[model samples]
Target: MAETATHSGTAVRVYDLHKSYREGAHALEVLHGVNLDIARGDLTLLMGPSGSGKTTLLTIMGLLMKPTSGRVELLGRDVTSLDESALPALRRRHVGFIFQNFNLLGALNAAENVEVVLGLQGVRGRAARKQAMALLDQVGLADRWSHLPDEMSGGEKQRVGVARALASQAELILADEPTGNLDSRTAAQVVDILRHLAHTENRAVLVVTHDLGLQEHADCVVRMRDGTIVEPHDGVAA
Candidate 1:
C-alpha cells in the first residue's frame, strides 16, 4: 500500500471477520475469521465453486450485509461499527456496486438511471443529468444515453450499469458475477472496463466470480471454500 498524508489512505482492511446465518436449528458459519487488505489501484478477484461463500464475503465488504464479528476499515474509518444511517452515507461516498443482473430500471433511460445515484447524493436536475451523460460517454454509451434498458443490448445495459457505478466517484467498487450473463466478447469488454477503473482511476476493486476467463485481468486472486478464504495468490500464472 502507498503511504499518504491523508487520513483515509488505505483503501480497505479487514481483520478477524466472521459471519453466521441461521439454518434450521443450527447457526451456519459463512466466514471464519477472514483477514484481508486491499490497497488502492488494485483489482482483486475472489473465486470459488458454488457454496464457497464468495458472495457472502463480497456482500459484507460492500456493507450490504453486516458481519457477525470483525473489523472492517474502509479508507481508514472503522465501518464495521457504523450505525445504519451512517453506513448508507459512508457507502454512498466510498463504495460502488456492480451486479450480474444489470439491475437497471426498465422505466428509466440509461442516463436517468445513472442520475438516480447522483440525485441521492444531493445533485439534481440538469447538473445530475450532465454528470450522468459524462459517465455514459466514458463507458462507450454516449449515443445510447437516452435509451431504456429494454432498448439496449445486454452488453450495452451492462455498460450503463458500470457507468452508474463510476458516476458516484466512489473509491472502492464491489462487483458480483458482473459477466455472468454475457457472451465471451462482451464479458471481455466489461472486464477491460473494470480493470481500467482500478489501474487508471486508482480505485480498489473486488470482484466475486467463478469465471476463469477473468483470471488474466486480476492483480490478486483469492480462493474461498466453505465460507473461508483458503488462499490468496498473485495473478501470475503457473
Candidate 2:
C-alpha cells in the first residue's frame, strides 16, 4: 500500500519520543526516542510483546498521555506544546480511540454510549441519537441500540466502542488491543472493520496489539521490542 496521507500526506507523526515513570526513587523509562509516522488510508499495526511500550506510544499519539520528551504532530498540527485545555477539543475533532476493554458505560445502552461522543462534538438531542444509531448500524449493531453493555457479547461491545469512537468522524483512530478480549473469529471481524475504516473511509488507523494473526491484514507493520522498534526476529538483550 502506498503511504498516502489523506490529510495533507501524514496523519500522525512522532519524533524522538521518550516516556518515563517513577517507581520509588528509580526512574523507569518506557519509551526511548521512539519515532513513528502513521499515514492515512492505511492500517498500521504496532505489534510487540507486553511492556514493549506499544500502548505507551498509542496513548501519546492519541493525546491521552503526555510524553516525557518529544514532539507529536497530528494532521500537521503541533500538539506537544499545546496546553492541556486545548487537547480536549483537538481530540474531539481529530482523534478517536478504541480500548481493549471496550470502555462502554455500563449504564448506557449502545445508542446512548455512542451519543455521548456526538454530544461532545456539539451534536445532541434527537439528532445525536439518530446519528448514534446510524453509526451503530454501520458497525453491524443495527437494531441493538437499546441493548446495554452487559447484554451484548464481547465482539458486540467492541463494535459499539468502534461506533462510539467514530461517532464524531475523527480522521485519526488509535486502537489499543481492540481484539484482545475477542475470540479468533470475532477478532478477525473487528480487524476487517478497522481496515475498512482505513482503506475506504481514508482514515488513519493505528492498532497496538500483540495478536500476530493481525499481521496478515496490515498495510504496514511496525514492531517494537522493549522500548524501541526492531526487526521481527530481533531479541532484546539483557
Q: What is the overall TM-score of model 1 with all chains considered together?
A: 0.90
TM-score for each predicted model, relative to the true structure: 0.90, 0.90
Candidate 1 shows a clash count of 0
Residue-wise C-alpha lDDT for candidate 2, range 1-238, written one tens digit per residue: 3333343367888888999988999989999888787888878888888999988888898898999999999998899999999998898889999999999999999999998888887999999988997898888999789999999999999999899878877889999889999998898798888877787788888888778888777777888988987843322110
- The residue-level lDDT of candidate 1 at 225 comes to 80
- Cα-lDDT of candidate 1: 0.81
lDDT of 1 by residue, 92-158 (tens): 8889999899999999999999999888888899999899988898889999998999999989999
lDDT scores for all predictions?
Answer: 0.81, 0.85
Which candidate number has the best lDDT? 2
RMSD (CA, Å), candidate 1 to true, equals: 4.1
